[model samples]
Target: MIPDLSHDRIDRLRDAFRAAGYDADGVVELLGPEAHVALGRGEPVPALRATTDAGPLGTLVRLFLLGQAEPQAAVEAALAPLPLTDAQAAGIVVADGDRLRAGLDVRPHGVGDDSWWVVSDLDSDLRGGRPVEPDHVLGVGHASLSLVRATSRRPVGSVLDLGTGCGVQALHASTHAQRITATDVSKRALALAEATFRLNEIDVELTEGEWFDPVRGRRFDMVVCNPPFVVGPPRTDFTYRDSGLAGDDASALVVRQLPAFLNEGGTGQLLASWVHREGEDWEDRVSRWLPPGAGVDAWFVQRDVADPALYVGTWLRDAGYDLRSPQGVQKAGEWLDWFEDNGVVGIGFGFVTLRRTDAARGEVVCEDLRHAFDDPLGPESDQWLRRVDWLRANASAEGLLAARLVTADSTVLEQVSEPGDEGWSPLVHRLHRTDGPGWQHEVDELGVRLLAGCRGALPLGELLELLAMGFGEDAEELTRAAVPVVRELVRHGMLVPAEWAGGAQ
Candidate 1:
């Protein structure tokens, strides 16, 4: 179903939603916390029971959010300002006997007064456990939310949101970007995205084509994509998840091609998945997809990895297939067979952040950071690029030795103790960063003393000299040994340049 993008009709619909308080917080308030959380989990019985005899807000929730048919009079009263006849003509609703049923899903996203409505085809639950359509335009899902949370919000001249399903990323980008251009290969998705933008009163250039084809020869200051990156066999079933490219090629293609679309100093962020083959490093496979030479600096953080069986099962279930069913089991076996034939061992999922650089050689970091992080990753992403730039600028021994450095304020030294002949002898010492990604490093006595002396008062060269003299080691050798260690400390944000010290800097 396509949404009506007429400005007047959308405006009236927005007004009706506002009047009924059918927003994120309002819905949660009307249905208690338990019911709201249950609704989110796709168990609509609690919500249906709670909103059965409620008010206009409840009626709207039943019709639009829960996908339940309501009495025509109740739906009309719920959408007061927007006439029911107008809504029917707009294809937002259809008559089901004496009741009114929603043609599509319109759900609220964001917090407080900052919320906006997203329009898309009904999901499996709303569609009564039916399989999703081939060209189903997905609404706000975990993948989209993850990209939004990880993207840096710093203001930029222009932004491009590639494969913008329902235009979720574009909507958020509008807050910081001077202009936004969103593209999708599916015309139905573009239509729904248009309704999403129009309903929110946001102006964004909408285009249709596969991947970067829509914006050829044009560059943006920032680009964000949550592409159809599901790693699978070369088959096209769903437009939102299946790229129709064999195995991880779709992900590799996007990563390899994004550099050409970014302006100088511009940054790009994307979510991707890659095949982890036996006897091959996942890092090598992903990093090889990055642009060559000094064109872009890249960071690949693998958040999770799933073995082939689990991976196949997860995506099969996601496509609304019951694993116990014969069709599901047969399909799973075929998928596993394909994986076996192709040497696929596991699948790694994560975020990829890139920046255009002019250095002779760009820094590329690939790490398995699977730990839970409390804060949003946006600040860390920005800080990582800055730190890499700083490291590149101070790469030479002479350059690094001339600058004074201070340990991060969030850095905490912990001593692990074990009972011995003497009372509580120290077994080990570790340095931990309390904020950001919560990186931890094991330290020795020398490392402890080295960090203790980093108070921003002395140049690194002088500090190394003093330490070597005290330890009766060669000064030159100590400098050579400590340089790489210092670089690592700075890279993980355990230390910062004193002149430009900030938590994220």
Candidate 2:
């Protein structure tokens, strides 16, 4: 059962937690570095040892975080401002064989000084190593953190957190959005989300329904979802990771239906997985899932791809199944049989960003981004959307030639030289971005010369003519060769339009 936040002691509970130093920093100080990291990895032994006989803070930590029972008096002392009876009434704690234990998993979650508590159902380990219930409300995990890091936090008029499990996305949305509405298909998950928002004192509208059902016919400026995007046979074993729709259709459904729920210029960010079939491009397969002629610009970045066997193994372990057990073997065989019956060969996991536009045709760009990043993707994604829009507008030869271009400040030109008999000679030149996704492009002599002349001082057409004269080449031939290269550079933010560079930078 979820905690009841409507009780009168809710404010007192928050105050007691703060007074007991039960925040992120406080927990870190109590557990030290090693135990804290272990606890984060779902290992509780070190944390259990550290919290034993520690203090009111330690008692509270053991009870709520480590899934241990605390003596009645110790729990009472930790929650002093609020009575133990009231906590029990609110379903925050329950009697456990002469001791008290936390009924809900409450822990501090936030960055830096912004400390907020997240309340959700206990994990599988705490629940005696069983698969999660069908209506389980998941807490913070890797997928949620990925979405948080990738979501654009620009201030918006309205925001929607679709399938907001335990409200992690909605919590982040509250920082930048004026009106926040969160929806979940499960009522149990919604209850936990409501308690989380109440304890944190953030005003959010909670709705119950599947997908966009609760907020139908309404458009928001921004939408974020870390939906049940697992690509496999459709099953409702766990609500958090299974959408009850057949093989990758869950992700497809969300993508195809996004345009109708977004305002003009609205953006949707989601984590999705798509099937990779043999002899067919994954890009073409996913592109088919998008709405045709819907004016939705899309950019998909595939981060990882797993073969069928590895995919099945990973998800089986994720569902708290021991792979060596008989049940696991049987389940894996059945899942693989289903996969073989279909054309499934591999599964690709990644981030998908879509923007609604008023233009007639929208651009679709897909690429594999396996390289590590130096910075968070939030700003990088926003800049990419802007760059794509610019590229779409000046797509034709005439429009590009008339446009003045500037090299980005983060652009770095690297040249590799090899020693020759006489001296060192340049072998290859690569242009790399130092700040964003660390994208690098190999450039030829003509490409290097073109980039050198693009300082936002003259139109690209003039720069091409000047380079053609220097190389003793025809200007028309040089233009024909350089336009495509320039478009690629502009699309990746290596070069920016002179007029639009100021705000974008």
Best-fitting candidate, scored by TM-score: 1
Instruction: Write candidate 1's Cα lDDT for 365-422 as tens digits.
Output: 9988899987667789998898998899898999999889999899999999999887
The local distance difference test score of each candidate is: 0.89, 0.87
The C-alpha stretches of model 1 lying farther than 4 A from their native spots are: 1-4, 43-46, 111-113, 502-504
Instruction: Write model 2 residue lDDT over 1-505, tens digit each, in one string.
Output: 5556664576787888989899889999999999999998989999988888888889989998888888999999998898999888877889999999987788899774577899888777766677667777889888898889888989999999999989999999888899999999988888888888887999999999999999998999999999999877778778999898888898899899987888899999999999888898989978887898799899888988998899999888777787889988987988888788888998999988999998888888898997788577778789888888788888899999999998888899999999999999999999999887888999988888888888899999999999989989999998998899888888888998887666665
RMSD of each: 1.8, 2.1
lDDT of 2: 0.87
Which whole-number lDDT from 0 to 100 does residue 137 have in model 2? 83
Error of 1 at 301 (Å): 0.8
Q: How many clashes show up per model? A: 0, 0
